[model samples]
Target: MSVPHAKLPAWAEYGLIPLVNLAVAFLISGLVVLIVGESPLEAAYHMINGAFGRGEYIGFTLYYTTTFIFTGLAVAVAFHCGLFNIGGEGQAYIGGIGVALACLSFDRVLPWYLLFPIAVIGAAFFGALWAMIPGWLQAKRGSHIVITTIMFNFIAASLMNYLLNRVFKPLGSMSLETRTFETGGQLPKLDWLMSIFGLSVGNAPFNISFLLALLAAFGVWVLIWRTKLGYEMRTMGHSPAAARYAGIKEAKIIVITMMISGALAGMMALNPIMGEQFRMQLDFVQGAGFVGIAVALIGRSHPAGIIPAALLFGMLYQGGAEISFEMPSISRDMIVIIQGLVILFAGALEHMFRPAITRIIFGLSPKGRQAAATKGA
Candidate 1:
């Protein structure tokens, strides 16, 4: 009861499969739009317009893309090490504390440039420390990484809630956030960059963090593809036993990988806190952590792929808001459903169409035909 299956080329494996899955997801989403008594094509037009019609919209879209890029790289890094670091939301949450402390301590004394690097270090350090516990447990105690990471997320949320409400809350302020950061602590907005190019974006929250995100992506590319540690991580992911046999230390790799992943997730705090909010606040992470899972899956866990994948999801988010505003029948929840569909197709059902693709490829290949003949015989 065995049949020969064709092997896809590298391009098809990395590029075409994801494209086909995305196309299928959009087609189904269009059907759902029809059921809601709306024109899918019109809805698509609105979404595109909302995300990129004006300078401000483009700015906002890139702003969201920046966060997604950080979080996506976080997840992708963990995936390469065969670890599921689902605690990115928690890591980002706690990273804010580092950002807050650094800003509060030096905001008045230090220049913006000096304070900025300190805050960045704080964020990465705290996030890495938070993730280290779970990573240690998984490596030394044989605990499941997914379960431990998920538990850490809840712990982080409760910890943040207590800190923000009891310790950081300013007098006479009912909000669950720290006082606004001093001028030196705040990041410079990208409005100047826009103005320099004769493009006005009307106070969009996009800032220097966007450039940092791009830099991070490039850094990850170098780390994952051009370094010895990256080779070990990928080897362990493929076969832990093989890695051990090859003299790679599994425990050390696991911990180091998670720390790096946590650091990336922690950096996401810079965008909302320093760049936009200018203060530490609850729920700042929103759901970018979870969305990162889908991004990593769809991007095939590569930095080059992650950048565009992050941009695509950013479009969906910015455009989804616009669609809900313009169409009476389409609620924000409907947009959520569409996003869920994309996740489903790209992640859970990714291989659903592979068998058919294999069949077609097999019919056209000599090696596959030889294998098929052997099977038939």
Candidate 2:
């Protein structure tokens, strides 16, 4: 007879396990800092102070958070449908093209309010269209999503390069970027929102897009947990055979889910392009697409979990920059190492400490101990 193992409590599974892993990661990272001849506690203080010490730093952190939130949701949504859509980088790149087309063509005539919606729709449509190719391949041709999506990223980069250099480059301009967007195309700053609370953010990039990201999170929650389509997607993810028995069309779900994921990733372009750069430029994505994978894993592929995870990464990014500037001993590469450790612990090694923790929890719980005793007999 096989002995049954006791299940961990929800709190231990969701809460304690992650905390222990994070602590271990940080502890290891601290050792790395010490080895490099720096004080770990001082580094920690600098990171915290840099990320949230001032109103401006807070704004920058939140600005980064907005991009991660959209991409993380994109990853999470597809994960729910059992799809690994790694094309967020490409989707976001094409989405920026869509936004640029809409803004450049109509910014002179349309009001900002009217233009913004058009830009958003363009971004979503183009993103979905780009992703449709990979989705169709996966659904119809049986192509693996991971391979196709990675290829699509390279394709997107090349396409954008050609467009920016040959097609959209303004006359008499040497830069590999489009002409500056018209005033009407620009997104208004949210400094007034801060001012309402008697705080100033000192020209940070945080904008209305932050609110849109939050709304997207709520929307993802509803789409995943409260809808029939979501149910079908989840069912398909759990078991294709069972889903087929229930008459859920796996192909349709795969395609639709990927398109939705692509759309969310595309929306991330709005923050950097319209809100910050005010022009279409090369490399605006800055690897936020890839970062979504880490965010999704750390967040456990849930919208509620994704928000805090995105914010945490945002803090790491902003704080990392600050510490690198202040402490020459802690280079940018060192900061990346620290970030890598977090990702490693949160994702790949997430369960490394789970068994030990489970035993401890089991020891402390009467019901758990009783179950273990019964199983042993």
Candidate 3:
């Protein structure tokens, strides 16, 4: 009486749909380029060349790349344990405040040797506390962390406003900014380090934090893939009840994962404050938490995959600035458009590839079963 629906093609499950999504994005980017009165190929070519071709652009790209690595990894870590940590912004703000406070306190007392590490650790600890508060609420009180973290972001912003406005402002300066310490506290120029490697660049903040980021990425990879803790975390992520039956302690794992995620979020601040700017400003996290979701999605929640995804984001960021310069009329919104498209495609890629993936994993499809039945005849 009724026709049966055909199963989705195995190719569709393998991410063929994502390719279609990408084609759609390219057409849209092309349209945008044309609307801006530039050749699509030319604009795209220049964008690619600028982002990856030039040494200066390369430096800028890496600068952002370093920050995004932490944010993306932060998001990915929580995702690994089936926890959603949307509080990365708040955690980063708290870390920023800690680093700011530390810089103001010990900048004069301690030599640069001790000051830098202390500030970084202080920042990370503060971030962990901020993140853990929400995590605790979720674990202990059944509070929705997503909602709480969003609220915390606002609270942290208000707290920053208070600090900038009254508490930390230098008297008679008529500015919220603290006095930049002239000696001993400044981050050692990575450019000098770069000179040892034959890289010459100025006004950019390349620092030891760059190496720290790579090491952190590797560390996250090892933690997620190579440890029993990682196995328990994954099991809990897939099914908390199942994990419980398998002897995985959900609460302990949840708290630990949340703390680690928060710390990773805190590490994001180092790239901006300690690495380049060397001074604190309010609102420095700059939506990195939200951007991190896209980064994680594109990375498929893999730490190693985060590198390329972060690089893609960093390139778009640099390209947006350059495009803004070349075509003042064109809004930086193009970057937003492209990023949205990438997230959309990457998210759908699994669905696109799902059938083949499932069949490969399971060794048969519905059609495969039917064909085998016919072959037996």
Candidate 4:
């Protein structure tokens, strides 16, 4: 007879395992630095200081964190529903069109506070609409969600290129972007929020969207844990056959979940478009959609976990830039390698240490000892 697999406690599964994985990733990253003839300690010092040394650094880090939080939550929502919504890149791209339309139509007439809500709805609606098509195909036509979503991403890119070049491009402007938004369209920076920490925001574009991202996280937690639909979603994710047996409508759940995921991804555009750039630009997403997949994996698809994971990635992005500037030997590509190592270890190889850790835990528990004795016999 085969021995049953051991299970980890919730705290160990969610918290301790991830921490150990991160530590190992950093340790390996240090080895890479050593091979490059630089002191790992020195590189680490610069990275930490660069990410948090000054208030402006924190602001920039949080600004990146804000975008990641949105995208991370998007991936997390879909993951919970047993769906991999890889079309976040496309959804966010199309969502920008919604935001731009709202701003272009109302920027001259409405104040920022008033336009913000309208823009939010517009963003979410367009993103949901974009994601809904793939969800429909998967639910109704038996198409593979992964292939459809990935293809939608490329389609979104092409669509945006055409729209930007032909429709949204202002006449006589050489740039392939829309006209810059006025004060009404621009989001207000959270200078007061920084002031509470006794630091100025400086040139960082950190804005109200960070607060919005937090709100979205809370909303997700409530939706996933506190609501009936969430229960159905979790059931479907755990076992579609059981869900169907329990009378849960898989088709409805898939579509709704994907729409919610897409909506979250779409809102990410608000940070860069309204919060910073004050205009939609090509490739403003900067791969946050793909980064979100790693974020969700590292976070274990929990809203609480995703917040810190997003912050960690934000640090990597900001600090990596600093590393490139401070140490010419470690170029931008080198920084990318460092980031990739972290993703490889933390995301892909996440369970590599689980069996060893499980054995250690089992060795320490009385019931586990008894079970082992029984298995051995």
Top candidate on lDDT is 4
Q: Which runs of model 4 end up more than 4 angstroms from their true locations?
A: 1-4, 365-377
Q: Show how many residue pairs clash in every candidate, following the order shown.
A: 0, 0, 9, 0
Residue-wise C-alpha lDDT for candidate 4, range 1-377, written one tens digit per residue: 25345567788889889989888888888888899898888888888888898989999999999998999999999988899988988898899988999999999999999999999999999999999999999999999999999999999999998998998889998888999999889999999999999999899999999999999999999999999998899998988999999999999999999999999999999999999999988878878888787788788889999999999988888787788789878765654565577678877888789878878877898997776566545
List, residue by residue over 56-94, the lDDT tens digit for candidate 3.
Answer: 676777787888888889889899999988888888877
> lDDT by residue for model 2 over 1-377, one digit each (tens)?
24234567788877787778778878998898899898989988988998899888888888999999999998889999888888899999988988999989998999788988999888888888888889999999999999999999999999999999998889889988888888767888788887887768897888888888999999999999999999999988888889999988889999999999999999999999988999999989988888788788778888888999899889888888888888888876665675677679987888678768867887898988887576545
* C-alpha lDDT of all candidate models, in order: 0.88, 0.86, 0.75, 0.89
Clashing residue pairs, backbone N/CA/C < 3 A, model 1:
none
What local lDDT does model 1 show for residue 224?
A: 90
Model 2 residue 2 lDDT score: 48
Ranking by TM-score: 4, 2, 1, 3
Q: Estimate each model's TM-score.
A: 0.93, 0.94, 0.84, 0.94
| Residue range 1-377, candidate 1, lDDT tens digits | 24334456678789989998989988999999999999999999989999888788888888889999999999999999889899988988888888999998998999888998899899999989888899999999999999999999999999999999899999889999999998988998788777776777776788898898999999998999999999999998988999999999999999999999999999999999999989998889988888788789889999989999999888888888899899978876765676678789988999888878766766788887776556545
Clashing pairs in 3: 12-352, 13-352, 13-353, 13-354, 13-355, 14-352, 14-353, 15-352, 15-353
